[model samples]
Target: MGDKLSLPLKPFRSRGGVKAPHRKHTAECESVVMPPPSEVLICMSQHIGVPCKPVVKPGDEVKVGQIVGDNDAFLSVPMHSSVSGRVKKIETVTMPNGSKVQAVRIESDGQMTPFEGIKPPKIETRDDFIKAVRDSGVVGLGGAGFPVHVKIGVERDKVDTLIINAAECEPYITADNREALENSWGVVSGIKAVMELMEIDRAIIGIENNKPNAIKVLNEVCREANRDMHGNVCVLPLKARYPQGAEKVLIKVCTGRVVPEGKLPADVGCVVMNIASIAFVSSYLKTGMPLVTKRITVDGSAVNRPQNVIVPIGTRIKDIIEFCGGYKCRPEKIIFGGPMMGLALPDDEMPLLKQNNAVLAFSEKEAARLEPSDCIRCGRCAAACPMGLTPPLISGLVAKGDAEGLADNGIMVCMECGCCAFACPANRPIVQNMRMGKSIVRSAKKK
Candidate 1:
């Protein structure tokens, strides 16, 4: 009972998800420092909302943490230069989401000079706290890229619980796990700060039981703090399940509250944040460093050296792979994030963004797709869907171009966690179909 305590709370379970391979080759590897690249392609539209406008033009000199792009939109965050460099040009690049975004190209001077204005933000109130968070350019580093200030700026009275998602539930992505282990103090401090700012009394850090080390470290950190001063910051070990880190599922598991469809966690008196996002809050408050670099887990069957690496934002994927000892074999596919919901890259030239937690390179053997046979009607897809939607039926409707029918079947609610596809014996692309169905529904709504 020195540091660990076995709470009597039951482990929450979602409706369905497959027990895929963890393949966490770099779970034990401490994150290595990646050298800055010769050039960077910082995208202006890295976050979820409106794309930022470039404040600096070509030939303009910039320093690390200098705001290069910004937007007045409340839903957006500023983009900063990760390296001291001169602006090469601004060009259009296709993001993994298949949308074209403007990217500022910078030729690195290799000095890594911090902006002169960099200093800890003064925050005496909630508005100041939110301003500091926004100024730091923090976002959902767990791959969502949602602006953090906008997420936590909700009405304090509306949120009773704050859930820290430490459940690196996806296989092979250990960035979050490493953050929880090495940055335990930052994580805990961030939680306390958020609690004080938001007036939240209850906070839970949800880590999968598989990460016993991280769970232990976080719990120890919390235990060392004054419980009376910090309120309740509990590190709860969750069941190891796919999509366990999804906001809806996490809220359900951690608080035993269902985030209804067409609503948010705030609507249900909860706020969810990624572990890295929380840690960034603590780091930013101390150093005033914006979200310019990211911790990425570079691993897969084709990776020569599977390890976690901290890289500056806008570093090319090719450089990251090379820094990890290059590929042992040619990768047939490279994905950003985890196998469950990662976006497959058409090439490795894409630059890393703030939300990129992992870059996985898969060899042909691992990336090979199995020929999908006719549906066996085994109901495995339905059994594995966490949303309780019937994947097979929705997939059929999507194949038939029945957008209205797909909408009627709740296809838009699909998180595309790939649980159904992984559990399918027939190798059906249930998640892909669900994505198509969602797109179809969106188009229908637009029309």
Candidate 2:
């Protein structure tokens, strides 16, 4: 059955999982509060699919809710201003990866007013409802930023189940959990909206046991009368594991189905949506809010004060740092997302995007400073791989610039979950090599 496919064979000596210093309490105990910035920097390409085309040029006066960029791609969403301001410029800026991309710069007028018809579209049929959602530019808020419409757009005949990922398994990432706890109604409504759009009968909510309060809140909300969400909504308490919040891993843990490599959850007759995505969707259905901003965790040792903040999509990192009482020590490294799966920032110039989950500021002492050591041939990296790929072999191939050999080992499939890097006693940058291998393979393929 599909249930059987969801559970993976637990290895006798599993090596892919790593235990990093959580540093979650720095922000976990506090609630997310709004921290508006003086200016915003909306990146044209925030989602996974395609970048939005800038609609307004420099010097155009716009309100907070105005659409600044709109792409024709069905998988793309329009970008909006978080603060009422004038278009300062549309130029390329350094991103997290140190690559320059088209960015929309806006000078804030200090007013948070949305454009007219910011009201939710009155949708009748499911198709219209879905179209509106796509137009709203909503995507997975759990760091993927996958277009919401595309997720629910799978052929009706194929999908049999919808899964809601409440599994806040990533350390120092509690935005999704906080959303589910504080906005249970929104979460429930979002689930209903998704179910209604997909016309699916069964939906499963997977929450990690670590968040008992969130689990309790969701359970109580579902049990209420007239919600019409009881028999259909099944909440599952998942085993606490790092990377358990990943789409594939969560699917495996909750439904027992392996999302085929390079295929989507729909391939297995299922659709997965993040809890924050669901909450955002529910609000979109009511208020017609585009995917402009989201809750992000600002936690780490470098920060004097660490707390989650509801930030606009284009807010600068410097603003969040200042809001959190600024850094106690000069941050040697700033990472977006978690220390485990997050990409390190070459500089803080990269504006917040829909895919951004947590903004982690690490002190030089906290950040790993280990130099690469000779691989002990211990096979620890291979053991830790969640995708069942041999990372050690891939890393070795990459070490010698053997792109073909790396590709043959399926190095491209590596999610760069950092399991290999974390588990390596030699402190080898196994994931970095894997990433380079992928880039080399991609470039050669382009030839």
Candidate 3:
């Protein structure tokens, strides 16, 4: 196993990403728990794939960890109640992604009662492991919302590397960093658990150089646990760059493996999981508490306190902001997640989803609309794309409604990290057009 540790530390390079301002205001703030909101709005479609159907009706009593909605689809996972409450209603609500999803509204009884069936799973086989993961209700906590059970259930022989993504590279988000520093044991345990269950011997925890404290803490934990004795559990420091935490980018930086176009990390002998997601695995295996609460960084120019807080899942954005001391100035734009990849919310009424990591409130000055101009053709957008995409060309095709041309140029490969738009001198909405191009391709394929 010690021999497996021989993989050399790869040089950290820019890799076409920009040097955006980190603005990690809450990096030093320890997370504090926020009281449960008076009510919760748990959306059934939090995970990718088919939306769950409500299992409990409007007058039903629910306990924490009780499954409220579920679906039999192979790609879907169940939703659990975050608080002991009575179901108020089940209705359709609009999400930040512009999709209307069925959400279960629960009026809290103020008593956090655990479900009677909440107990640690007895995992003696691979099937048991998968079932436990599904029951835990874990997903990609870094904002992707892909079901974790489906990811780990990939054929074992094809996966040789497990990458723990701790590179919270997005600006204004520090939830993953704080988790790495404070829950080092849980992080290592989670990594080991996956490695053993999947029969993988090599694992890498990738943290950006910006988070020196997290890197140092994780390394120390690995050494104490002797994780390197049985398998390679190395902490690889990444160059501090925007979109550095992207799955494809992180795989390339950590394992020197390039995920081919229209493929997944598993297709290249790797599986990437967020650090916080792995930590939750460690916690759930011990306490049997499902994914019900989340640690989120509440910050931005308009936030009054701007701190990291732990709140129940389905907690409304308005309640969380109020807990953070409300707005210092009237917020002009509210974003869920980091500025680079987060979705802008029309209002603060939306409840926090399983994938949400931060809620950024920008004042009018910070959220000032920038006028777009003709492309300068300066090539900055291409140079700044971490995926090495020519945004100007793809965006032009999208504007002309040339979905076929966009697909020929690999438009679907764009992760829409907003680097191209951020680097454009003319302030063009390159990512927005790229998104439109992708939607066109997807809708055509579906048809």
Candidate 4:
């Protein structure tokens, strides 16, 4: 596969994605509102970097947008409450990965008052601009909640391109696309704000071709904005592909650059931000608003309705479902994220944090369980792997507990996109094994 022969090949079927029943009818039809929960658990280590230090002790009353956790570490960002509440306790809880970590527990007062320090700052200098982004505690809402300040404050000379990911590639995950369409002007304004803050002139918005309406709105907004928008903002239409929204894949498809193995996109003179993140930037810069709320797709097959919701962060999943007219059938499982990559929650009590983009409830029939069968040794997993690594080999080593072999086979590069798991005819839990393999390899490396 020469670069010339394979580079332009867009053979991927845009709609070949497996359809888990959509249980989102009740929720998606209505505008988003705050789903009141009795308690909210705020995680200190929600961001990728160091855990934030708790700013308030137990018995302290806190308002929404109040920074409950702050750290002096440059890599860490502060955590704010999504509701006005009394500090219940700071204790450890099991995260999605099944590891227990310290979390600040708050019992809601139901007042939902804004925090006193939620006002936005006047953006003047680049330093001031960066500070505003950091103070708001904004992260990538697409999925991975990487800190936003790190990108804004990056070495100016190292970055040459800014990529806005409007590619909501996952099926049923229309949060980003909807945000881009509804807030097109905001998206343009946000990017311009980023350009002013970073002094970078070249920015591109990469949207999947499936989202024609969003693409049109973005272009229209860019044309209307008079900030020398010519040639600076380019909307690249990517061929719709599962996992095409992955940072590296989007970077490759949009900019034709391969982020070198174990290297950040900044190393290749690029920084990628989600459309929602850009919207947040606009909100903070224009309205002086903190990141107190965001839009989410509250959908799945077991609901009476399906709709996107503008939800306050930290709302419990149960309340979200109830607000959507409750379950249509006995929801056997509730998953967060899209059907391809979302994690099945043990219970519906998990708080909707910055990282969660969708709250999916599925009936027993919708939550189809596949029995693991013998591997046919087919290379379909390899062909479907966007990273160009063989998943079967990784799964093999994982089955044999060959952590070293898994590492040698490039297990770390797997993004856990669930493409292999979705493609497997043998019904193997390829993604889970790859995740385990990556973890074991990481543990071994740490030693």
Highest lDDT: which candidate?
Answer: 3
lDDT of 1 by residue, 77-180 (tens): 99999999899999999998799999999999989999999998888999999999999998989988889998889986888788899999999999999998
Ranking by TM-score: 3, 1, 2, 4
Query: How many backbone collisions does model 3 have?
Result: 0
TM-score, one value per model: 0.96, 0.92, 0.97, 0.90
Give per-residue CA lDDT, model 4, range 1-447, as digits (tens): 112112222322232233233222332233456565677888887677888888899999989888889898888788888778899899876777786667788899988887776665887888898888888889887878888888768886677678898877777777887787677888888998887678775777888787777778787877676457555777777777777788888888777888887888888878899999988888887766567676878766787766787776766778777777788998998888877778889998777778678888888897879899998988767777888778877777887878788867888878888777778899988887888898888887888
lDDT score for candidate 4 against the true structure = 0.77
* Each prediction's RMSD to truth: 3.3, 3.2, 1.7, 4.3
Quick one: best TM-score, which candidate? 3
What is the descending lDDT order? Answer: 3, 1, 2, 4
Provide the global lDDT of candidate 3 against the true structure.
Answer: 0.89
Show model 2 residue runs off by greater than 4 Å: 1-16, 26-30, 225-227, 399-408, 443-447
lDDT of each: 0.88, 0.78, 0.89, 0.77
Q: Give residue 366's error in model 1 in angstroms.
A: 0.8
Q: How does residue 434 of candidate 2 score in lDDT? A: 81
Candidate 3: residue 55 lDDT (0-100): 96
Q: Which digits, one per residue and each the tens of the lDDT, describe model 2 over residues 1-447?
A: 244223222311222455544445733454656656788998888887778889999999887668899888877877887777789999987766666668889988777777775887888877887788787777887887888888887776578777898877678887777787778999988888877777876777887777888888888887672257446776777666666777787777766777766788889888889888888888888888787778888888898878778888888888888888898998999999987888888877678888788898899998869888787988877777777778767766776877788777887777778877888899987777888999988887888
